[model samples]
Target chain A: MLDVKAEAAEHSGAGAPGEEAPPLVVEGLGHAFGERQALRNVSFRLNRGDRTMLLGLNGAGKTTLFSLITRLYNHRSGSIRIFGFEIKDKPSEALARLGVVFQLATLDLELSVAQNLLYHAALHGLPRREAAVRLKREIERVGLTDRLREHARTLSGGQRRRVEIARALVHQPKLLLLDEPTVGLDVASRQFLLDHVRMLCNEGGIAALWATHLIDEVDSGARVIVLHHGQILAEGPVPEVIRRANASSMREAFDKLTGERSE
Target chain B: MRPIHYARCLRGIIWREALRFINQRGRFLAALVRPLVWLLIFATGFRFVLGVSIIPPYQTYIPYQVYIAPGLIGMILMFQGMQSSLSMVWDRETGSMRTLLVSPLPRWYLLTSKLIAAVIVSVLQAYVFLFIAYFWGVHPPRLGYLTVLPALILAGMMLSGLGLFLSSVIRQLENFAGVMNFVIFPMFFASSALYPLWTVKQANLKLYYICMANPFTHAVELIRFALYEKFNLEAFAVVGGSLVIFMTLAILGYDPGRGLIARRAGTE
Candidate 1:
């Protein structure tokens, strides 16, 4: 295999002029536990105002990569710069600038919708008055105003998932890292979430990395990174990657790249 | 995330515990029976075989029931602390604990908050046990004994710390029950809670040293001395040392990268 970690300079295309540094610049990332290697010298840079989609199969190390980015786990040999600060040297600062919604919903189902969001906002240290204003705006954006007074346990899975995403954005992070954001969502809710995420990337100028196994979630204009069996199989503009793929749908392209075939 | 914001998360965790217990009063009532059985039936029956004498803070003769109060209270704290933490394993099994752990806040603070809430419940249950002992006619100096508060707090902190450590280490909820056999009973039985170190010395010289070595014994002795309105510096030091050591272990147990909670859960 080519040395992906050593090619950082070649791949580090600075964002367009007037655009800020990439929200995340990861290079030579590697980790292992005892004898089992979890990640191997992975390198990728994600810039602000860029809407990048990450497609990977199960066991593709997507969650491990996200966990390391969040510093839920530390990297053994790598450098991760989030918002211009090394993650280890300044974890709170780096994490504060990024909003993350993991595959599992972090909403407290026992608490009222408002209570859950308020609690999370307080965790991020948003002042009460400030959080209230942001909470109102984000809740409405997710169409959860009517459900604020009810317990999250009562909301449907889609509604609960949306509320969780809104909770992550209450602090106005510069980057949004969503892991399988639409998992278990009905078709309508999935579309609703995708539309809002795209809007956030374009209108708010927020950089985002949406990790999913679903190919249809990718937007035509976005950059794409395809991971398979713990390695990056492809990375480039969506159209160009597919042009090389020579497949009709993005799924076919993903399958062709990963060498999976229909039964 | 801001570090001080952790206090709010702690309050939220305590609130969850309070809500669950209030909704299920039967659990507290049910737990009360075990200690009551030990105190009224077992202690009374064993009193005849065991000789009693004057220890410090005792004006004259003391009954076996009064002697074992501090030990029983220590037992309450340890078990309740383990009870709350063991339930965390249950929460993880059912997938609720994941919701709490994945929040932006640090994981250690979340476990600490849960421990504090468990301590409150344990201390409250202990107070109830004291009141029932009063009705059973095993009274000590009521006002002087209020020192039990600080003593209970110290013991509660230690037990909570112990429980937090276990939550991270145990592989499965069922395996945690085994922890009780190895840890809980030995610590309680070998402590000075049931008898003074002097009494243990008369019976078994080695046993006296073991009781002196048990930190729980010091917690019970601290409460015992305080009940008579006397303070033992050595006992106080032991309690303090145990709290610090246990809390340090708990902090290490919560390190996400190496924590046993995930390791045992088979999630990694």
Candidate 2:
């Protein structure tokens, strides 16, 4: 086993009493694929128990940033700390507290929904009894209790998304990262996933960073970080970013921030 | 992660692989068909023409079927290795590999677990081939069946490791079929899988050296000796060394820093 105590000390000194660290803190993060830069100087912080929308168009580096945060790709110039644990220096410790729902469908189409969740639970090192309990709870949250025995391929697009979210939550991660969670979902399914995540923030008290291209998915009160062309263009609450850009709507604001002159 | 967590993760991956294999009835059948065809058709045709010498593992001249049975076993495993690697490409294209990568488990554990799973399937296929070959009159000495288990496992590991390395290098699933044709046939035909290395030396010295140098040749030799309840130290060293080397390359190929999978994220 890795020396957890040494890793904790190496990344961040002991915290003061009653001072809880933010869920995520990233700074000066940059990544390039050969000569083409995918992300440059991206920085952000997510408060505990808050939902943040990562708004960007396709090819805007949302997936790249998520890949770095999830440790799927290492950034060349940047730092990502999850709950005060550096991603590069202490990946296991940092990743243990994180849950992710990727943009692509990751479920085993051949396996039952319950089986898929149980497998994921085992991957997280949850024992059988504990995994079963968590699995049932999360499945209920996603409203797929009856479909548990069905193959994932038999489910609708939204149902599969819910199952994925449930699978991500079964391990009780402190932070959830969803990359374009609603890309292929119908209107109702998209709303269902968003509402469920909101409930998780409010009730379960889990912090989340939801990535999406559609601007309407960004609730007014939610913290918004706009990424365009591999760089952060604007970050703050929705109203503030819009007012700063002198745009009336979030769409217009995004256009202006990305330098897309309105015709 | 604790040792227990690592064990749990490995178990999950292996179980999932087992589940996938069980569901793919066509793949299992295809795995058996290729080796069986070679054992029945090719070996039968060559049985009259080729005469195996009194190799250390063999006390007398052996029939071509008996000679090539172990080679066919090697063929089965080589195909299995490539088959598993092909699935790796499919998993990447389908995004299941990403789910696995994001896990808190070390990348080495995740990848090794995958390789072990492929080894398990290949080993199972080898036994099935052995069972069929037994009834087909290619029986080794009485103890050969029992003795071949370790040989199959060792050979399976080496071949699966090679497959994992190939999966890490081959970028596209469509391209893998072509690569597999180039790899599986060459590794199977260039080695002692069909004829003795001495026979190749008799016919062509250069082809003999290439056969002797091929790791699949060593794998077949390892199994060939083990099936006769004998041992071949040279074959053991070659297969073992190749396992370590290929496994290392595969593990490095999966590292997020410089591996092929890292480039996949940007392209996607």
Candidate 3:
């Protein structure tokens, strides 16, 4: 993949130039798991072509936020809009424009790769011929065209993740949400996956929200949202977040902002 | 999503379920063995012990294996319902159910499709058992084979619905085997699946009443009568009524807001 950091820097202004709506807008989002508040008063906007890193440590409510955005869980305390469509009120329309790669691999291990993709396309109500076309294009881009007939369980962890990414893109979503997608990957696989996703945002003009605790995943030009203890501590460009925390590096800024050492 | 979309989704679910069923050879053999054992082994020993009167479906004195064939078919489907519950638990734990639930389609549609898939598999098992029974000397009328399909379908729906209801209540997969044994054995033994109701009443009036009240008894009677091309309105009403009730309950149990699934996930 090409250098996404350079591409994002070239297209620095990720959102529309004074356009009416960005790709995603979340306002006053609050959620709770029973008595425990997983998220509170959290809000952010992801613009078209922007790569936003949802930075937080373990137990920082990152998964909860992703779950709410993806409609895995519903919240009444706040509102979320994707492409100007409210999620709760117009879920089908909102979700139609969104693609998600969960932390866990959701593929049916018993199924072949092509079968898995076809099944997802059917769920999205895509016609078989159109699904086949999209499957070809997406897998080709991910360099997995030859592995299409292989069973999902036989693939390496990174290869399966790539297939998942390709599967998410089969319907051509405008906004993508990934929750700790690189948790179990090796170093090379992590870089490859991150770069591939970043390249998708840069080339396809698709907005992305990548959630992770690792600071290294955040590019200098990417938007950063520092979440801690179920709340947003800071949100801005990488350097600005660092400057606001009076820290010299992203690691120091995360430490000072979250008030916890990154292990 | 349009009507075509719903059709495609249903097709996809059923296709996946059918493929899974076909791949599990052990499940097929186990389903076959359980009912056959009741016929070939247990029925031979107990045939003389329990005297069966001339039932409507039976013109004259019928051997125990011939009498118990339809009941054993019901038993096969009942166990199939439990098997469906096990798969549901596995889906939830493995997170594939999350994928199904996230679809734009309504939850009721997704659940109904799953129930239908289970019923189809159960009916297939019933036919397979019926086929083998012919060779084992437990033969029904030639036309009885044709009538058994509808009976098996209805019985499968009721039993699968009951299984869905149990799955909604059972939280974990590890705990399901004991629950399945508890449910299947009692449902089979307490009903007319093994012996005739009159014989039970002769032995004990209270036990006979209990057997009379058991829905499994009605299920067996519905199949048994249908196997001989006979219609039992009372059996039909009970089985059909119980099917509707259990199906509605199962659908409600899968509802995300107040359902057991939501409650368990929320607590987690």
What TM-score, computed on C-alpha atoms, does each candidate reach?
A: 0.82, 0.93, 0.89
> Which TM-score values does chain B get in all models?
0.89, 0.93, 0.94
Off by over 4 Å in 2: A1-19, A261-263, B92-94
Show where candidate 3 strays beyond 4 Å. Answer: A1-21, B92-94, B202-210
Q: Which candidate order results from sorting by lDDT in descending order?
A: 2, 3, 1
* Clash count (model 1, backbone only): 1
Q: Which candidate, 1 or 3, would have the higher TM-score against the true structure?
A: 3
DockQ of 1: 0.23
| Worst window of 10 by summed lDDT in candidate 1 chain A | A1-10
Best by DockQ: 2
TM-score of 3: 0.89
Q: lDDT tens digits, residues B66-96, model 2?
A: 8888999998888888777666657643467
Best by TM-score: 2
TM-score of candidate 2 relative to the true fold: 0.93
In CAPRI terms, model 3 is classed as: acceptable
In model 2, which residue pairs have backbone atoms overlapping below 3 Å?
none
Q: Give the DockQ (2 decimals) of all models.
A: 0.23, 0.54, 0.39
Across residues B20-104, which tens digit of lDDT does each residue of candidate 3 receive?
6776768788879989998889888988987777988899988888889988999888988777755665654345765666676
* Candidate 1 structure quality by residue, lDDT tens digits, A1-263: 12232133224544321214467788888866556666677888776667889888777778877877876656778788776667766666677687888777667666778877776676665666787889889999999899888988899888987897888888888788898889888999999988888888777777889998887788788889887665787887798888899977677788899998521
**Each candidate's interface RMSD:** 3.9, 1.9, 2.4
lDDT of 3 at A246: 96
